[model samples]
Target: MQTSPKPKLLIFDVNGTLLNMDGIKTAINQAYQHPGAFTQWFSWLLQYSLVDTVTKTYHPFSEIAEAALQMTAASLKVNVDAVFMQDILKSMQQLPPHPDILTGLDLLKKAGYKMVTLTNSASAAQKKQLEFAQLNAYFEETFSVDAVELYKPHPKTYQYVLDELNFDPQETMLIAAHGWDVAGAARAGLQTAFIARDGQALYPLAKKPEFVCADLHELAVQLAAL
Candidate 1:
């Protein structure tokens, strides 16, 4: 088994990493009247987030989600209006964490691991999301990519967190459900734990994550042992 020297800081990715987006998926399906619109919308949201990063354009995550929803609605020949998009955005803030989250996070907290969240969601939305999910107590800090005007998968965003927390890359472990995020942290020099949520897969060319667990519960046990 691979064992890491216990890290000084554990930085988590929000969204699908810590929180469940099943509600948002249901919302999309209901609004678009299409069973597959949810998946397509999420893919487009992530795609355009990177597009903005690569093209030097910046928009808050909520805006990107809204735009993605409109595009998804249009593609499906569904006349989803701005009001429906706004409702979706509001629902996003109220999502619950995955079922494994509470026990997993509690285990880490009890073990004296310092935890924080690093998210693409901007400050206000990030706070609301965490608070709504009742996850605010587990994290010591919540960071957003907006601080550096770059999103995850960009080295600057990771560096910004490390810099603010006064921790070296080697002293940190980035825990995420997205392979692209794990790849980014690996490139930035942090150890990574990939939570292989259903429908998520690692990139073939990306560096292997130092740890791979089926969910946060499994990850918690491994981290506690370390």
Candidate 2:
């Protein structure tokens, strides 16, 4: 496999990449009293993200979460208070990182790579989530699509990270679990790494990433060799 020179900057996606949000899925199912409640909300979240990107409409990630939850509740024929929905959304702030994340991030830092987090989440929630995970110190910056009023898979969202960091896409590597995210970054000219967190499939027609690893630690080792 071809490898570029050492990366000057490493960008990570939050959900399903560093953090395991399966707890949120369980919470959603429990709160809605339905087995598919979590899947429903997740699908709606993606839908709204696409809508926001295409329409140039923006809402805080928390608001999107609440709105998606409400939609899920309505579809399940259940009634939930708006305040209660907000509480559930706030629970996202308490998610923890995967087992390999901190150690992998430590190794990357020791190898002298600059690291940042890029997420589609709102800034406040992303901060809270990282702080709770105790991995906040590993990153020099946390970027959210909230700044651009768009979501990932949108070229502008990835461009926002490059613009803020003032780094060329060629020198930056985007590490993500979602195929769409990796594909978008690759399209934007950033080298990409695919972390197979849940055996999720990549976009069949998307530009393939430079590397694929089972988890963050493996990705770190591959990067260290570059």
Report clash pairs, candidate 1: none
lDDT of each: 0.92, 0.86
Give the C-alpha lDDT of model 2. Answer: 0.86
Give the local distance difference test score of model 1.
0.92
Candidate 1: residue 114 lDDT (0-100): 97
All candidates' TM-scores? Answer: 0.97, 0.94
Q: Please report the candidate that would top lDDT against the real structure.
A: 1
lDDT tens digits, residue span 86-168, model 2: 77777778888989898789889988999999998889888899999998889999999888888888888888989988999
Candidate 2 stretches greater than 4 Å from native: none
Prediction 2 TM-score vs. true: 0.94
What stretches of model 1 exceed 4 Å from their correct place? Answer: none
